[model samples]
Target: MLRTVNVTRYIQPLREGGSLPALAEADDDFKYVLKFRGNGHGPKVLIAELIGGEIARELGLRVPELVFAHLDEAFGRTEGDEEVQDLLKGSQGLNIALHFLSGAITFDPVVTQIDAETASKVVWLDSFISNIDRTVKNTNMLMFNKELWLIDHGSSLSFHHAWMHLEERAKSPFPFVKEHVLLAQASLLKETNEAFKKLLTPEKLQAIVALIPDSWLEWPDTDESPEALREAYSQFLITRLNHSDIFTNQAQDAREALI
Candidate 1:
């Protein structure tokens, strides 16, 4: 079972881009970043964040633990303003209080301290899930305690829905480069594939799919069982794994070049 702690409402606003409301934690003991889900967008994005975080941990990635949080109705309001009640209305679901990775720096693809081998593996993982979040500009990766940590998986597997309508989606295949780090240092690709197969079982998939808030689904009137959703996701994983050889080959090539 995942452990959770009660988070206080007191937080400082982060002056950063994005419509999601963010705040810095008051207590220095653990750096807790609060992100409020946009009511208008429903809770699909938040659900993705939660599920992805858990899956990453299962795959041996250094992902910070996350928990659901209830936002006080007056969470973002200034000190004492009665009229602001409605402004903070309809806020709910999953407060991700992640452990702060101290002295960590974002990996830059252009001027990277990480070797080509490692970079290749990271890219392969991102591609496997079709994650567009960890691009050159926003590679939400951090290095702490001499280890790499992956954060912000909100953007992965998003295209699962659009695959039905989009024609060119299959053209851009997943990349499997030889200079990947996983191939050189560890068989991360093989391990991740195995883990994924184990976790994508019908039972596990149902549990994960059930975690998504009902409000996020497109057709609120339609009754979709968690089991059905899980099966769909399972198929998706199987499809990706079937092409695991591509990533492995890429990692091998990259590793050989470095040696």
Candidate 2:
């Protein structure tokens, strides 16, 4: 289970992407990159972040700590920027935040050469989740303490957005692995693919999917209940895991073309 923290301060907004994630300090005196629920995709982005980040952690990959952040209504009144105020007001309930890595640097493929084992594992994990953000343009990874840590999974598990023919989408191979920044280094795809299959069992995947807050799963546009939505996410992941070969082969073929 994830810990919940109350945001004590609204530090500054990070303007890199459309979501406008911000740096804030919590009651625990730890700084975090807060992903607001009121932003672009709303709670769906938070759901993806929670699910994707936890799955990466379960695979023994480096990922910053994830926590449930509560934003109070008072924050909206003090902000001078009308846009920011609206964002805060809209996000008054619950949000998600990643523990800030104080001196982490953006990952540069040229500067940081990952070993085949790690690279293959990362490739397989992203392929499993269908995360499209780990490209050359936006690696969504950081180099902290000489370790590769993944972040910003708001674009992951994208099948939830369309919410149609989900089983088909789950069984589909992620062709975008060709564009992954680590494709060149992912030489152990076959070995790691088999290893990861054992790591991400159906029970484990369902447990990670269960981490998503009920509030986030209550889709505003959908008539489906929160429990149903959670079950859908769990089943989708399990089905994808059962058919991991489709994506693993696609990634291997892509890597072969690169080398």
Q: Say which candidate scores most in lDDT.
A: 2
Give per-residue CA lDDT, model 1, range 1-259, as digits (tens).
4444444554454434253444445334455555445533345555556667766665556776665555555455663543222324545434444565657777555554665445544655665565667654566777777677887766667655453522233224544333232334443555544555565554554455556544445434446664555455556655555555555555455556756
- Candidate 1 yields a Cα-based lDDT of 0.53
Off by over 4 Å in 1: 4-6, 15-17, 24-29, 39-41, 79-88, 109-112, 115-121, 160-172, 175-227, 243-259
| TM-score between candidate 2 and the true structure | 0.98
Let me know the TM-score candidate 1 reaches against the reference structure: 0.66
Q: Which stretches of candidate 2 lie over 4 Å from their true place?
A: none
TM-score of each candidate? 0.66, 0.98
Top candidate on TM-score is 2
Candidate models: Cα lDDT each: 0.53, 0.92
Candidate 2 lDDT, tens digit per residue, 97-147?
999999999999988899999999999999999999899999999999999
Candidate 2: C-alpha lDDT: 0.92
What shift in Å separates residue 127 of candidate 1 from its native position after superposition? Answer: 1.6
Error of 1 at 56 (Å): 1.8
